[model samples]
Target chain A: MDRSAIIEQLTEIMIDVFDLDDLEYRDDLSAADVEEWDSLSNIRFMVAVEKAFGFRLSNSEIESLDNVGEMVDLIQQKLA
Target chain B: MTDVLTLPWLLPAPADFRARVRALKSAETVKAADVTTLAAYGLDLSQLGSLGKIVDARREELRAEGRLRPVLLGVAATHTVDLVAEALPATALRHGLLVDTVQTDYGQLAQAVLDPSSSLAAAKPDFVLLALDAASLGLARPQFEAAAAHEAVQSALDYVASLRDGVRTNIGAGVVLHTLATPAESLFGSYDARVPGSVRWLIARFNQRLTEEVVGDSDLLLDVAALAETVGLARWHDPLRWHDAKIPCALDAVPLYADHVARLLASARGLARKCLVLDLDNTLWGGIIGDDGVDGIKLGQGSAKGEAHLAVQSLALDLRRRGVILAVCSKNEEAAALIPFREHDEMVLKEDHISVFVANWTDKATNLKAIAQALNIGTDALVFLDDNPAERERVRQELPEVAVPEVGDEPSDYVRLLSLAGYFEAVAFNDEDRKRADMYQANAQRASALQKVGNLDEYLASLDMECTIAPFDDLGRARIAQLINKSNQFNLTTRRYTEADVAAIQSDPNKFTMQVRLVDRFGDNGMISVVIFDRGLDSWHCDTWLMSCRVLGRRVEEAVLDHVAAAAKAAGATRLTGEYIPTPKNVLVEKHFEKLGFVQTCERDGGGTTWALELADYAAPALPMDIRTTIAFAA
Candidate 1:
């Protein structure tokens, strides 16, 4: 999937899983940007992102992720 | 992506009747009919097969047909003559209204005339029928010697009477009671050797004690079951199939059942059957289609067995014609079952008559689950009919949630079983029941098409989607509550709410409630979603937000945000905020807002993620999916 498409797909999943109606995910969007983005949500988000992008995230890696932009980059690298 | 509705057809039952039952099963109202003859099958055995579900299906059918007539439930006539006078102006219960059946035998015309209350003048019954079996006549147990026994019978009688003549005049909406005598056989079993006089004596004694308790007019009527024995004709297990006998003809010599049902016709409310999930084998016709070829299938016009099935099919067709939904769940090979509907000349039920056909060799319980899923209905709303006790037991064991019936064998007395259960009895008919089958069938087509699209955006774009988000109102209140109870996935803060709860929220101005409806290229996802926001000073909070999983992958979430942001901005709110409360099933969308553009505001102790989006700077992403959005001004 294209990067923007992956970002878009991530956006859809976030709105659906977290149920946030008002959310914006640019490449720079960080953990501080979303209301429902927490540890558990982070785990869920990571799992979902891994599935959607055809990759996996370790506990340490998931715990280290702090923003949407970083996660997007990680997913992009995995895709590359 | 096969539309199950369009799949090959099966069964010998009429298509229309099945359709009507299917339509009513999902109705909001609960319609109840009388089931007099059902007592013969023995409640335990009757409850084992389609009997229970059929009865319940009947109630749903009644509701769907909008035949929710006021009902009058009549109890033992011999025990409570005062039941009628006490039962008048009855109160409506979950089942319907109750009425006292007339106490006096029709032959005692002088007694009916003499007793002021017994006189039809004081006690007008839309229809009066006997409820108890006359078999008790011979067993004439003496008056309750114990207070507890006395209270038991009295309470049962009192409950029956109270239901009939409660202060609530609208108790039995369209139902009525009538006066008639119990036939000798009804009091005595078909095999009973008791003489007629002895039987009458036993019944008279039984009635005398009950009548002495009350001083008012006995507004009750006698039914044919009090006169002659329904014997094998109406009884559930008369092994010697009386080939040439019709219920009218069989009752000609003993008109109690006919007369009572006819009199009750005044209160005859149209009962529609909802969701008739039928089994193929011995229940629908004489033999299994798999074992018995199309030529051998006993449906259409000829033999008694064939005729019996035909009679049931005709009844189902009439119900469907009046608005019932039909479905099939059988254990036979799909190909063999389809042969009857596709090729058999005498088959009454066609492919279109059925809303869903689950023809796999899976257990009936699993099949029923699939059926419920396909119809988007609760398992409690279905009535499964089968001829095998073993299959019924499996369903009862594994899928205890689905209602199975007691009437497994004995297809000959299918009509009588319905009359006895009164589960499908109704007072009137409605448009919803009639159109429901078609609606569900249409839904099947939509579901199949939806499955063909890949990914959420592709699905959304293909839908040619249009969404309307509005606050809770009278029109969508019930739908919103139903979604709260039904929707599993794509539900945020899965707060279950009932109609009353929704009403409470709608009445509270402080709580802002809204719902979303999506209509795509295929059809309307009737109220596919809902959202509730509690507005705070600087920021708005999400009270509840949920959507149907069917519409999940689409950028509809973006549309919801776009709409919410606009509303928040219009309301002068600085920020729009929401939280993600993770439940095991909803992990699929936990990161929803990070993708949307909302910034994290706070995290709760229990792993809750709260995010906020500034109203001034909120911008929607370039959604790859095509989606049309509309906002209904909050009222």
Candidate 2:
């Protein structure tokens, strides 16, 4: 799947995770952007991302990724 | 396809039963209707969290209706419980909220369980849930010496014991301990599982110690690791989740965790199921037994379906060994139905493993009721398993009290489905449990013999029954504690005591504890009765007097009282006081004092009639047969 397609799926998962219908997702968005997004919830969020995009990220790799854009970049590298 | 929301499959059980099933399958948000239905089974943690908002609303609604019973739960976790907090509340709400827990902070479990003046002590919880992991307990790492590992295990156990004593002394809420989930991705690899000082070996050793500890201590133990194994270790413990949230278990396993804890609480509340009623044909074997003769039945290792049937049989046998009565209810000719068990070479289940087997062309609902009648257990205590959907559905519709988990088309998933039902969640396993099937089988044999003998008293004498009454010993403690918790129908005063409570009562100079073991020509009944009497100056008060329902009408109760009166007289007590406590289940014991010829004494304020018997004037209850007695250990 292309980056845009992956992002669309990721956005849907993000919406489901936060339990908000109108919750929007952007590449530049980070944990600060979402209200319920915290360290505790990041595991669930990253798990959803891995499922949506089909790639695994280490704990350190997840900690390193600062924003959704960076996650998309990482996904691109892994998928490629 | 029709809308799943229509819930056409819900039938008579609940209007939204399908919704709960759907919730487990796909996260469509947990509805209020889903709450009661979901409580019946487990869900993955992710599925549970999906319904958080609905659970929150449901909680408030429950509180408004005054249904939520407040339980102060002292929680100490190795992880951040943001997800557990979200998941467990809904699970609790669904299971009728025996404990509407007000939990303490994370990382404060030691303080909650140990210190009297801890914030948790101030909360004054009804129970304490200590989710201690091996890492936090300092036993996860590979030790240099096996002795060092042994020391750590001993220290952890001692620490827990001290905490329990502290809680009893200070907070008064009993502790509930969890067996550590063997950390996925072992440090020592294969060596961990084999080497004595390795992490896996030490962890296993620690679990053994915990088992021993729970048998001695009063606190309940939850085997999260065993539950984790059933859920699959990879699925149960997610490393990423652990690393990020400090959550030891996988987020998806929250429902299972909650479910197991809920069942334990239910067992503590005396709601555990007693019997498993199985079906033949596809349930017990791979195909129809009538169509496929004994020689042709698919029950051997050649086929996957056959192996699955064998697995179910293995599990059923295991349950029977754990005091869960096994019975068969099948809609086929008796000969054809039993042919697999009797003659089939590959069948793991034999006719002897089952306490009750009814095989005929009768409808299963009727057969199940008959089975319960023969076994002297309530229909509610029975769990019916059948491979046929129609049979399962019919049982569910007719006997709404009976648990009917659908055995799907896939044979591989058979045992998994049954295990998830949690019908036989064990609080304690003792020698009695292992020999329960044999005892019941002997009861059946006695019932059959009772028909042949003309004289009732003569028949009793023919059995050559001998009972040995002795003071409670350490070897009999677990079974004694179990009987106190489980023996309900014949129980007077219905006093439920844990192992620790039983120990205290046994050791107290002011109280007397004695247990009776019966051995007839058939077999040993194995510690069938317990009596705890409170010794007074001139009068002895009977606090707990109970006999197993299996031994009813065998004149054991009469023998017990006669022995107790003799003992009381020898101890220079003139009067023996007994109370008749009325419960919904114990009506058989209501007129017990009257039958035993005890004089009418002052009735206790606790809704029970108190009666007294003068020891010197009391005559030994006459028996047609010669009585044998051994009272070696005095209380």
Candidate 3:
């Protein structure tokens, strides 16, 4: 899958985790943008993402990523 | 009566089920599915992504979906118990529970149990679970031959018993007790495992003590130690997690723990499956007995295939000892199927162990119906296990209540797969459990005897039966409450009572509670009857009356009323009044009061008969059987 496709799937997972409605997914959208995406949900969201994508992200990779765009970039680099 | 085959659809087709389980891509999909639907799909522990995260939200979803069967649980842990509390919601969903958990202050099980203002008292949970660990119980690092080690175990048990007694007296909830888990970090190195004095062996005995203590009591023992064994002890606990948060169980192990707890609670509620229906052919042995002769089948001593089948057989035998009836439902020639069980030297399950054996080419759904009829149990109580996926699917579509375990292709995986499903969840173990296999065997004997007799009266007379009627004792109270809570057919008022309620009835000045046990020429049907009657100034009012369906139509009802009339007379009553409240299942007892010659004076407001019998003309009815009766602790 292309990077944009991976980004789209990841965005859908975040929507499910936070139960987001009337929300648009942007490349720069981060945990701070969503009210329900607290630290616990952040871990839960990432775990769901990893499960959906069939990969594991280390703690450093999860912490270092700033936004949805960076997380999508990490996924693309892994697929490469 | 609705036929088992015509039951409404419960599970989807297997391929569709697998597809649905696979399609659970996100938390939204999972939360949307009902608890039973999730369990039917059989998602693995890891397949469910971070169950801890979704546990709370799923509670509301479960309620919204109307899939929530609530089990208000009281949890008093000796250590950190957040993981168990967290895992409970999702894991309990597998067994169909909302799992309303009430937590006590850490290490304050006694205070929580005693204090009326405590959450345990206020929540009034249906069940109480004591989450114990070795370190908290003071047996983590005992000396090899230390006397203090044994004393400490005894003291811990007394402490737990007091808590159970307090709950029984105050709240009337069933207590679920368990022993400390044997840590993976053994103090004595490898060789000392077999030594009786070693910590490992001591821990094993401690677990046995825990189980034995709750054998006849209203309490149940959760086999967390067995759970720890199934999932290796090393994997069950995390040292860092324990150090940081005092969590005894690992995050990953929480789901499995919750599953075990849910099973115990379900069993307590009398929802456990009773019979195990087995398929022959590749299921019982390595090869088909029809093609391969008795000697040709691999089930005995040496090979891995043989050992796997043997393992399954051994588990079946263990299940039988614990009161799970075994029956055969297979698509093979009856004689050929008998060859493996009767003629084969390696067979662990003999013909005597099985309650009903139906071996024919007919579809298993039909055979299962015959087995249920022969055993006189509901189709819901049956657990059909077969290796053929097509046969399994057919049965699932036909009878959804029958628990069809996902026994994979290999014989090696059969035992592990069935054990994980937790179909045969048992509440209490007594002499009755050990004698259950024999009772069913006696049913077969009774059937043959009935066929030979000329009429129903003649058949009942030929049995040479004895009924022992007595007041409630400590030993029989659990079984009494068990029958009161679960017995549907032949129940008079269908009044559900806890063990504490039964205990209260015994202690009350005006109330008289009694239990009846029967033994025929064949075997003892343990505690087949229970009655609670209230003594008024000039009248006796029946509060709760129920008899086990196992002893129905054997003149036990006549004997029960005869005994009650005498007791009512002795207690200075002029008249006896009984009520028959109808439920969907208790239609078998619709004419119960009328049968005893008690006139139905009127019907109650909520649809039940108010029956009255004048004690002036009361006389014991002459039946064809011999009876010995004692009324201990008479009113």
User: Can you give the TM-score per candidate against the true fold?
Assistant: 0.47, 0.76, 0.82
Q: Which stretches of candidate 3 lie over 4 Å from their true place?
A: A1-80, B1-38, B43-70, B78-99, B104-111, B132-170, B182-216, B239-248, B601-609, B616-619
What lDDT tens digits, residue by residue, belong to model 1 across residues B542-609? Answer: 87888776565667788778777777777778898888877645666688778888888788667768
> What is each candidate's DockQ, to 2 decimals?
0.01, 0.23, 0.20
**lDDT per model, in order?**
0.53, 0.72, 0.75
lDDT of 3 by residue, B1-635 (tens): 11111111113224443334334424464442433545544332332333434545455655555434567888988786655675566556555466778899877777888877777888888888877677766666664555765776677667667777777766678788886677887655886576554667667767878677643366788877877876778877667557645768665565567677887887776667889999988888888888989888889679999999998899998999999999999888898989877788889999999899999999999999889878878787898889899999898778765788766678887776677778887777778778888899899989988888959988888888898888887778888888886676778887777777777777788887779989899988989999988889899899989998887789998888888888888778899998998775678888988878888999898787899999887778898677667754476
**Order of models, best TM-score first:** 3, 2, 1
Instruction: Give me the displacement of residue B90 in model 3, in angstroms.
Output: 6.0
* Candidate closest to the true structure, highest DockQ: 2
When sorted by DockQ, best at the front, the candidate numbers are 2, 3, 1
The DockQ value obtained for model 1 is: 0.01
Which is better, 2 or 3, measured by DockQ? 2
Each candidate's root-mean-square deviation in Å? 27.7, 6.8, 6.3
Location of the lowest summed lDDT over 10 successive residues in candidate 2 chain B: B1-10
Q: Report the Cα interface RMSD of each model, rounded to 1 decimal.
A: 25.8, 4.5, 7.2
Residue B610 in candidate 1, Cα distance off native in Å: 5.9
